[model samples]
Target: MTQTASPLPERGPTGRRTAKGSLAAKSAQRVERPAPLRQVVYDALAELIINRTLEPGQHLVEADLAEYLGVSRQPVREALQRLQTEGWVDLRPAQGAFVHMPTDEEADQLLGVRAVLETHSARLAAGCASEAHVARLWELQNAGLEALAADDGEALVTANADLHSFLTELTGNAVLAELIGLVDRRVRWYYTPIARPRGHDAWAEHAELIEAVAAHDVEKAEKIMAHHTERTRQAFHERPEAARE
Candidate 1:
């Protein structure tokens, strides 16, 4: 394996490096082990896809990634396989992987799932969320605002994830929370760069959602969240390329 380029560093909202190597490498394959190269490859590709660098329908070149990430072909192949399983990439037998362009029906289906799970989350949060949880969500909302103002696509993504995760935790339903968690990452993948231009109405939507949640308006919260998810689905189809931003 040739380490031709530096590993993909953990990036900040604006494509700056926020972290480097850790304190030490107490290395082992299993215990105290580094993340599998396949996972690193998966994250790198997903980030690129979510950031709009890897356009939808673009082919993913495994050999190129292997050389770029300082790994062997095996890991790159595995990562592409994982992405395929996650609905981000499509692979044909004897062919290769390309970015996934979900159909209008498919995007609607995804939004349906998000709507069901997240609306339930909002209702539960209204009943169960505490003062601190609401506060934390507000903090995350402000953070998202900052990212949007600064035009930091990645940071905006991170902040959005934080907000959803906070709401899930506040709901106090571990099972439902786990279910949402499974799809949450995928949701982020769909929205990160697309429909998120600076000064988009997205910030206002966030504030409205937050206010509904804080007011413990379960019906209002559920309705707004459902509408939000549906709007996102529409955006996805309206601009087919919005999947990659």
Candidate 2:
């Protein structure tokens, strides 16, 4: 009789493979780890800058920031260097690090691009938004209203971003969302000072946009978004002297 190849060893009833199993099965499992300290510090510092907690043109002392963040100075230094590269901080040869102050030209250029993107986002959202999506927009709008009533600047900023971001999501365009993400933080930085003063009118325009999207009125949605973003751009330009600094 012809010899046949030995049959493979049976796997354990519990499904654990024996040592004689496939080589791929013996590979080590991946170990998930916390983010590196330098990256964490970088994110924290970038957030502070965006939220206006670290005011534009304010000095960034590594020791003070390290102490505040409860980390060592090396990570803070690395984070500051990254922030400077990203235009969030300025590194002076003799004076050290300071927050980067945005100019009118910078604000206009960015906000103008934002208007174009957001208007397109609104038009697409109107065409495709489900009732559930519109309801979520209202919820975000209400959150912004509550934040405004409480005069909580930070919460207002967050809520405003949440509403706009959700609208961008309703557009069903990944590339558009990615473009918005690139400018979102700096837009927040420019918006923080104006969040309170612009709160009432901004939310009103949001209501109108939501209504247009809910009605599936594409042209109306686009028009409302265009106006809303232009108003924000105007608000930035007209911000008080203190806010400009």
Candidate 3:
């Protein structure tokens, strides 16, 4: 007599093994498509911290983060570790993680460095920017103006970042671009809270800087950019209460 054959096991939509699959099959599937849960958690936590949703000095409970992110505690722990390395979080032994509270000196130093890099970028952009690049700068300038007029703080901040990033790109220096990119996020975090108070004057300065760049006046562009960044740094220091709040 012929014996009855066992039916095939059910597979996932991607034809990967189901929970009932053999350990070897499951391991192979995980290897083929490694989960990026830690990275996802890291990005989410970073965004929250940068936007001040997770305020400086705020405690970061791994379990709470895992629950909030719909992830396991392991990924949250790994993400927090990475954030600590990047200066976004501070890990304390037995006390858990806390959002990093940047000191006044740290802010000043970083902004000063940004001023130097941006001034050089603006000068290079003035020399190398084509007509098309100038036109794009005008477009970003207009977008920033619109954001200001609408009193949209987030949009204004984003527009400001985009304009600066475009200028760096115009310089055609990959190394310079990379360095600016590294610092740009923290700069934006610092700038976001002050975006509204600084809106009108900032956009006007951007207009003048754009014009200088359009004219290919390297010295003028550098001077304007230097002044522009310095003003922002001063504004941040002047509004300490606003930044803390």
User: Against the true structure, what is every candidate's RMSD?
Assistant: 8.5, 16.8, 13.1
Best by lDDT: 2
Q: What is the C-alpha lDDT profile of model 3 across 188-211, one tens digit per residue?
A: 888888898889889999999999
Clashing residue pairs in candidate 1 (N, C-alpha, C atoms within 3 angstroms): 13-155
Give the Cα error of residue 233 in candidate 1, in Å: 2.1
- Candidate 3 lands at a TM-score of 0.83
Candidate of highest TM-score: 2
Candidate 2 whole-model C-alpha lDDT, 0 to 1? 0.87
Better of 1 and 2 by lDDT: 2
Model 2: weakest 10-residue lDDT segment is: 8-17
Q: Give the TM-score of candidate 2.
A: 0.88
**Scored by CA lDDT, what does every candidate get?**
0.73, 0.87, 0.84
Query: Which residues of candidate 3, in runs, are more than 4 Å off?
Result: 1-35
Candidate 3, position 176, lDDT: 99
Query: What's the lDDT for candidate 1?
Result: 0.73
Give the TM-scores of the predictions, in the order they appear. Answer: 0.78, 0.88, 0.83
For model 2, the stretches where C-alpha displacement exceeds 4 angstroms are 1-30
